[model samples]
Target: MELRHLRHFVAVAEEGHITRAAERLGMQQPPLSQRIKAIEDELNVQLFRRKPRGVELTEAGRVFLDRARATLAHYDGAFEATRSAARGEQGRLCIGVLPTTLFHPFVPLIIRAFRTTYPQVSVTLDECMRAEAIDGLRNQQLDIAFLRSAIDEEVDLNAYPLLNEPMVAALPSDHALARSGRDAQSLSLKDLADEQFILYARKLGPSFYEATMAACIRAGFTPRLGQEAPRITSALSLVAVGLGVSLVPACMQNMTMNGVVYRRLKGAVQPKAVLMIGLRRGDTSPVVRNYVSLVRKTAKTFRPSEKEAR
Candidate 1:
């Protein structure tokens, strides 16, 4: 029998009369009686006993009522859950983030805000390189990513700028400039002319590496490249070991590497560490949209500017 039959049976059982039950259900007495009959017939049992005064429940009717009530409660709960998901109040979101993002002060702030706002929604975060983040977004393996901007135009994704972090120079504590007291003030690229440079791997982003080289060229002489590291942390670690000085995002300053000191760089050509929120081109999940919005808001509150860092 259909849900309507169970509902009608329940109404009749509660009202103790078909005529009154039909009035309560906004229907005719005959149809309500027929629905109850259909349910009993399907179950092959009598669900009620009729007397001149009113109707009473049979032993079978008492057991069936409990089952019907439970079924209705289950349906109500399921409907509520589906509606919550549709409204972005519940669901799972997987986000891929660049390793450098963890160094940014605002990343954790945004995560905390998102967790508080959507307590019921499950969030999973993965630290990935820029290329891997791009691949994850394209393959639908991640709902969104926080990464550097300047993505390829051909990728099927949408990116919104989250923050712009200026680059800083990480120097060895005992280096000449560090000894001369010149490291405390904002430094021009010219100051690094005689210093050996540690470079980020070319594979990370050729354009970014090239930008660093260009900045050095504009300063007067090409920086002497002494070593290459695959990630920002590795580059800083090399600097800490007195391998060579390197220019890195200002956010890296938050990391305390022994013997490594961060100095502000001077020049009109500030290489920015941009944070972007990326999603598949056609993603329509409400949860993803809400998360993106929250990220944008958080970014606005704590976003760094080139002049501010300088």
Candidate 2:
């Protein structure tokens, strides 16, 4: 009727003698015999053929032995699964990232490391806008989000700064500046004042839009705003086609977008882009804690000359 009874039947059936079975189970022989008798009475069938020296399974006992063993195995596995879930060793992590965030090496590198450490945890990665990523965390739809650090101002979420790199100019390969003799040297932000700027749309990232615009203003002239894209990487595509010049994160230079070139920008402080991890406030899940700890460790070793800007 219960798991203990199944285990008792299996022990007696396997040992072939009630006295020896009780010894193996750390119980007395008399109580073991009574339990066996109770099972037979409850089922209205004889489960063993008793002999002077030992006992042997009846036809029905052989079938019941197989079922009892299977039942114990299933219960043991389910019990372990519950413990694993409580320990955070098994479950799911739903992660969100902005399209441009993954371009930074740290994003994928940390994710790979986490997967290696917690192979039992399932991870789901999604690319989302800043608003969507924030909303996902608030609604319990996301466990973590990699996004621009500008969102650190958000009161409802906790954002950890990961990387900070100066902004640079993205020009069409055929543009005069991309081909000029000064290409090897950094240029003042004022140099691109006359060119139409391919801007990241303001609605998707208001802080990014405003910071870029403010940097241009400090350069002595407001940039001529042209085509707008949802993200800096998408803006690069427009720059490649001569739609307009763009100011983007220095790390973006690693993107192998054909016809696009990155040049260092001088005197543009506010245009710098910073990456951060955003999580819901008061999240105590160990899996999320483990990921944040990894992010902190990885962020510490990032050097400006390596895996980031030049």
lDDT leader: 2
lDDT agreement with native, every candidate: 0.82, 0.85
How close to the true structure is residue 47 of candidate 1, measured as C-alpha lDDT? 94
Error of 1 at 90 (Å): 4.1
Model 2 TM-score on a 0 to 1 scale = 0.83
The residue-by-residue lDDT of candidate 1 on 129-176, one tens digit each, is 878888998888999898776666846788888777788888998777
- Model 1 Cα shift for residue 99 (angstroms): 1.0
Give one digit per residue, the lDDT tens place, for model 2 in 1-310.
8899899899999999999999989999999899999999999999999999879999999999999999999999899988887777788999999877877777878889989988999999988998899999989899999987556566878988888777778889998888868755567788887899888899887756777899988878888889789887789889988899988777787788999988887663546787889997788898888788888898999665643565
Worst 10 residues of 1 by lDDT: 301-310
Candidate 1: stretches off by over 4 Å = 11-24, 28-30, 46-59, 88-90, 176-186, 218-220, 266-269, 303-310
Cα deviation at 27, candidate 1, in Å, is: 3.1
79 in model 1: Cα distance from truth in Å?
3.7
Off by over 4 Å in 2: 51-54, 150-155, 180-194, 210-224, 265-271, 284-286, 302-307
